[model samples]
Target: MKTERAKEILVQLLRIPSPSGREDRIALYIMDFLHRLDYDVHIESDGEIIDLVVNPEAELFYEVHMDTIEPRAEPFVRGNIVYGTGASDIKGGIAAILLMLEQLRKENKDLNVGIVFVSDEEKGGRGSALFMERYRPKMAIVLEPTDLEVHIAHAGNIEAYFEVDGKEAHGACPESGINAIEQTFEMLQKLKELEPFKVKGKYFDPHIGIQELICENPFYLIPGLCKGRLEARLLPEQEVEDVLDLIDPILDEYTIRHEYTEIWDGYELSEDEEIVQIAKKAMEATGLNEFGGMRSWTDAINFMYNGTKTIVFGPGNLDISHTKNERIDVRDVVKASEFLMYVNEIYGKS
Candidate 1:
């Protein structure tokens, strides 16, 4: 596709607001775009996901999530950079996939490939989980903002919530009450010492930290109730249950009530694997030679868990993804499209 046309599509996609459960508008837009290109497109999960079939029998699929977190900025272009919510998070990747399809159609290049535009990725990943229940491709590329690096390993994650209760005392009291907030902090410190946090890998190390903390009764008194949420990124070699087991004693010691809201195990692909080799070749062909692990959980975890060989790759910098300053270089989007097209060529032959 022409560079200007790709930029236009990127801008159009970024203008649409599709957050978590609300992805119908973007899904419809993509359906129409694929339909106009003479491809079989259909909505699944009550229009929460869109499936575009270039070849139904194809064993390879390209996947992108349609939902972003929440819009922090409107779409705009300054020079070659496009700034907007979801611009770097995923819309940029979406544009590259669309451009690749358009260019393939224009060139009349018949290749065995399919596409999935999923929703709820920013929230619970229900869209991808639902898709995996029905289809398992032989190989797949789940796109996210990776700055063109090929990721064979993706970090797993755990989101936990806990509540602690303590006795309240007046502001002038010396040691009459226990501070629940302080107790919460101590609990987290103990949990952070789990073996998973010490485990390191070639591409990524495990991370654990508190994301939210709140205390009840904000008067000039020791808080009686404290609630908090902590998130952790596990290495590929770690298991969610194993980490939890190590923290069970700590939680018990503090008498803290805890619940795990989300849990997903990490996964990795061998360097000699066919999908990895092909992706690396595609990156090299496009002048991108970096190989890194995805520090954030992605739809790739779902596909890989369901027995599909999957990797995460795309344009944009992940660091700025969810911020108001989210943006992407239009040139990077174009380069990603070119890389994907090359993958299609060589993958078809293999």
Candidate 2:
């Protein structure tokens, strides 16, 4: 695969808006590209799964997502970096995957490998979860922006919604009704006391924040309802039940009601695994030495939970992901493509 062609593919993928849950357009584009290569690609009925099979007997596979965070602007490259919404978050990884596939095709050697591109990773790992439920691969390499390092661990997240119900009364009679908005603020203050929940050895304690608060009513009357959304980032060793227990003491009052939603468990890989070993070898071969930590939720957790030894590896800096300034270094993409190709070769031998 030529460097210019790789860049062109990256730009095209970035131009397509594939926000979480809406990846049909980009999925179609990917299918078309793969079909033109005469590869055996199978897409699920709902179009969320794009499976490219290089060798049916192969137990090794690579995974990437088609969806990205909402876009802020069109993609454009200035010098060695490409700027856009999903550029760094993962279109770069996708581009590298495409190029690697092309290289493998040209070699025409027997390779027991495949690539699975799924949807809904940005929201929840529904696509990955579904794939794992149906297909059983011995090991997988999940592509996410990791600046070309091998990410052996990732954190999970838990989101909860809080509601406070209050009675409404005429403004003329001030004390007759409870101001739910004020009560909500008080509740927030209590929750804030658990700030920076980090301990020395144990997985960093969850970081909590109030994501949303809504309470609107006529000034002449006290609001009857107040709603708040709370979210926490939990380390791999942490569990949602543990987080819920920690916050239970603060909700003792009868005024506040809460429920947990969007719980993602975390995972970590032992360094001695074959996947990690091959990745480290690949990094050494590629002259790269920056290992990274994926401190947020990723589909890798789904793969690991389902019994597949999985590692997250890709290009770009994750700090810019989901931000308007999201971008990736073109050189990094090229280097990642080379590294991944080497991993594939090493994997085939193993």
Candidate 3:
């Protein structure tokens, strides 16, 4: 696809506000775009997800999430970069997918492939879970912000929310009363000493920390209650129950009230797998040679859990995703589109 056209599509997609649970608008735009290409599009999950079938019997498919974080930003183009929310997180990848489909339609090639655009990826990943219940492709390429590298492994996570209670005391007094915030910190420090938190893998290291901490003190007295959310990224070899078993004792020691918000296992695809081999070959054909593990949880986990071999890949730096300064280079979109096309070609031959 032409660079100008790709930028236009990306800009249009970025302008729509499809945050988390609200993805109807962007889903409509995508359905219309696919319809114009004369492909059979199917709307699913109360019109929150879309499935476009280029070949019904195709075992290979591409998937991308349509939701961004809340409060979408206005889209703008400056030189080769397009700036906006969701620009890097996923809208850029969506644009690339559209361009690849458009090119395939223009060429009128009957390649064996399908595409799925799902919602709720930024929140619960229920959309992908729903899709897996209905369709099971032999292989899937999940589009995310990977800067064009093929990611065969993805990190899993255990998210917990806890509340600690302490006796209130004056701020000026020392050792008179317990500080709930300090108690929370102590609990976190002890939890960090768990063995799983320090485990390292060939492509990713474990990340364990508190993502959210809250303690309210409107008066001069120390806070009596503290609430925190802890997140732990586990390697493929780590077991969720094993880590939780180690954590249960520490939480018990602090008498912390906690609950698991989310738990999902990490996964890795063998380098000798056909999908991995073809993806690497496609990246090489397009002058890309990077391969790494996805440090973040992606829809690939759902697909893998449902028995589909999946990989994560796309354009844009994940570091800037979900931030106000999120942006993607127009050239990167073009390169990603080219990469997808090559993947299609190589996979078709195999």
Output the number of the lDDT-best candidate. 3
Residue pairs of candidate 1 with colliding backbone atoms: none
Better of 1 and 3 by lDDT: 3
Least accurate 10 contiguous residues by lDDT in model 3: 46-55
Candidate 2: stretches off by over 4 Å = 1-3, 46-56, 107-110, 165-189, 192-196, 200-205, 217-225, 252-255
Residue lDDT tens for model 1, 1-350: 36688789999999899888778799888888988988887556644454334454678888899999888899999978999999988999999999998899999996557788888899877888877776778899999999898988888888888888888998677299998888888888887777778767788788889889889776899888888888988887788888878876877777558888888888889989888988878877889898888999898988988899998999999989999899999999999999999999888888
What are the runs in model 3 whose C-alpha is more than 4 Å off? Answer: 46-56
RMSD per candidate (Å) reads 1.8, 3.2, 1.6
> In candidate 1, where is summed lDDT lowest over 10 consecutive residues?
46-55
**Residue-wise lDDT of candidate 3 within 190-280, one digit each (tens)?**
9888878876687888878989988988989777889889899988877888888898888877755888988988888899988899888
- List TM-score per model, in order: 0.94, 0.86, 0.95
Would you list the C-alpha lDDT of every candidate in the order shown?
0.85, 0.78, 0.86
What is the TM-score (0 to 1) of candidate 1? 0.94
> Global CA lDDT of candidate 3, please?
0.86
RMSD of 3: 1.6
Best by TM-score: 3
- Candidate 1 Cα misplacement greater than 4 A, ranges: 46-54
Q: Model 1 misses residue 304 by how many Å? A: 1.1
